[model samples]
Target: MAQLLVTGGAGYIGSHLVLDLLLAGHDVVVVDDLSTGHHLALTRVAELAGRGCRFVHADIADVATVASALDGVDAVFHLAAFKLVTESMVAPERYFRNNVAGTAALLEAMVRAGVTRLVYSSSAAVYGPQPDAPISEDAQLNPESPYGVSKAQGETMLSWMCARRGWAATSLRYFNPVGTHHSGRIGQPQRDAAALAPRVLNALQHADQPLTVYGTDWPTPDGTCLRDYIHIADLNRAHLLALQVLLPGQHGIFNVGSGRPHSVREVLASCRRVTGREVPTTDGPRRDGDMARSTADASRFHAATGFIATGTLDDMLASAWTWAAHNPAGYAT
Candidate 1:
């Protein structure tokens, strides 16, 4: 019953959220610059859901355009940002201007439009390197990379806005988001993608390109990086839950993950089990800004939003393989 606006509605997570909203009988509007997002994503989500949503081609940094998109919007899911850690480290100015300052502009626009609720897409990268297996939400936030720092700053900005305006805001600090929609209609590499999820899918999309297992010397069960991989569908559902549960004059931070750590080798083995193919693999040194292990402590999110992630590791791998096999070219079909 609410009219929602998503800032990066043409990207992976954003597009899925748009579909979820529309299918729930809510009005949805999207604004995306098409810089790294594909407009075809919105088109396909509309087709699959059998419901149409409006999309405006614009950047979030542009206040006027953002204000226009906020017309009649009751809340927003702000997911627009450049997400590559290496890229962010190299060009931090872009990250600051786009992720941090762009969010500032969006908040100003929302205030002007009297839109007072938001679900901010944050990252667990903001937690930086942790020695422990599963880090709690209350743990110190010492983000090492510029990307993480930018997201942390965005959270601060959102807090200020909520304090001053009585806006309902929930900053979902996402762990690793993997896999795709169960439908396979919308997933993977609509554009150039980095990180483990896309890299794995891209390797499969291209013929026999070896999946690189980064950092094989960590002190873990397998010596590979341990991550909290949450299925994108579960993560998307939590957003809906957060949006519906949050009311005005409230603000909080919550972690989104499976709450269990899965090693890179396990993920690769799962990929093989799902696809029944021997995916090529290689070992490499750890990339910059990566931790040995990081998982979410989901107690807070469960108590607050009543969102429980039920998808298993096999389910994540299977859904990812399904989408990759069908749409190797991602919406080019």
Candidate 2:
């Protein structure tokens, strides 16, 4: 069994990945600062998997601590970072310090520990507002927000590491990730999430809080922004596939998405249909750095690794609704 390290194991996506790795017979260690992650998520993940993973409460920017956590780790899954676009725009320096500088420190620690295999969790935000319907990997990265810029810079660092350092790495540029695990025991436990799916679920659970439909005048089918929403399960599977197929001295960047564009209104309709509840929404002006449409061309990853996203919009909403209905107050409930 391989010993693996996940940088943000207490967060939503990282928890799922840690469980997946544990079930696959790998020894996993999670290093998290808990700045925005929940310890309860990892607790529940251990309960569900019938085994426990080693948890080290630390930050990736701490090269000394991260170097210690990399002990015997065969590979690393880098997922810890501040993800809110609005927050990053307000404080660009924070994103640069945490996402960019922190990543540099982690790479240094990995090299010190003699571990080179890495799978970076990138974002489609790196593409900003592309004119193409399905953006390919070849598209020029013109990130609008500081958060996006930080991710693009991370990929650039990985490219250099692979070219000169002989590191085997893959950067999976994810679109909007929605849905919860099928068991509903672990999901998006954060309450103030900025993602549309979590915000919709939160609105459905509260009578006084109505979901804000941002940018109702966008140039899309329903005058709302269109995005490629992939199921969390599908997104995690892509990571496992990449981890399994990573070759020595090889580097690749692939897009992990559903390749189907679902607009904001479409998502609301699906939530209403799946939950059998009226989704209350109020139209609002567009948020800064918000894109009109962002879809993915996932054919490159599919051809390279035979990985395809198989979840529909309704399927994603149904799973997320199950989690929200079960845990209205999140893990605290």
Number of the predicted model whose TM-score against the real structure is largest: 2
Q: lDDT winner among the candidates? A: 2
Stretches of model 2 off by over 4 angstroms after superposition? none
lDDT of 2 at 2: 91
Question: Model 1 RMSD to the real structure?
Answer: 1.6
Residue 18's lDDT within candidate 2 is: 90
TM-scores across all candidates? 0.95, 0.96
Reference-based TM-score, model 2: 0.96
**Worst 10 contiguous positions by lDDT, candidate 1:** 190-199
RMSD of each: 1.6, 1.3
Q: Write model 1 residue lDDT over 10-119, tens digit each, in one string.
A: 98888888998998899999999987788888888999899879988998988888898898998899999988888887899999999998899999888778889999
